[model samples]
Target: MNELSLPTSTEAAIRRVEELGEALKQNFPEYVFPVEHSLHGGMYARTIRMPAGTAAVGTLIRVPTLLIVSGHVRINSGDRVYELQGYHVLEGEINRKQMAWALEDTEITMIFATQAKTVDEAEREFTVEFEQLQNRKKEISA
Candidate 1:
């Protein structure tokens, strides 16, 4: 069997998130609310809480973000799925799309770094349109 490798590009991540969000909505409709807040250091964190057996999907801005899991969750990102329990933190350059399946009553938080002054501004900076990200990616690659 081939290992599922995470997509290396932000464009692929954005596409993956959309696909997963659709599937999750059809299969687990109850766990889709995300509450976001701005923190110091131009950072923002979005939290999603769900009951056991429910799942949720989230998309990220192009910035590197932190993942904080409280309780138990099975996270599926890129081409891989993994489980975490209790309180844990993972930091990395995540794809634009991410999803979590609740193994227990779980709360997952995504922390983003941004310079925006308000929650709305932070959200706008964090969730830039896919087309813009794609264009920026192209410019960077070129």
Candidate 2:
């Protein structure tokens, strides 16, 4: 007879991601959510631009089982570059980065997780949200 072994930490991380994804879908039924994953010890970055003369605000929430290096940038005065914020987080860590900017600007969010398990977990969580969003879109189009 073979004895069953408990899941390692990586498997636990993946399971946590799945749980979070379901929670997001149940809680936020109005907005489209996209989740994505990348390799461990890699970088994740994004930049968004708002229309001229408008202001924008954004938020990022990371779970406690992943490591991340995060930062943001704001463009002001039409050629001046400013670093808005930056920080790092490891497992059992929780942090929030928020920004408000004006005058036709761009903001960027970057994350780097230091383990393959972390990336895989993120990917799983994202897949759940993406599927829900796609279904919503289809309903709207129909």
lDDT of each: 0.63, 0.35
User: Which residues of candidate 2, in runs, are more than 4 Å off?
Assistant: 1-41, 63-93, 114-142
Best by TM-score: 1
The digit string of per-residue lDDT tens for model 1 on 1-142 reads 1132223335665577678777765775443344545478767776766788876655454666677789988876566677778987776464356667788888867687777777657656666653333323444668
Clashes of 1: 1
The sequence of per-residue lDDT tens digits that candidate 2 reaches over residues 81-135 is 2334454332322332222343333323334443335533543333333333333
Using lDDT as the measure, the top candidate is 1
Return the lDDT, model 1, position 122: 62
Quote each prediction's TM-score. Answer: 0.69, 0.31
In model 1, what are the clashing residue pairs, if there are any? 42-114
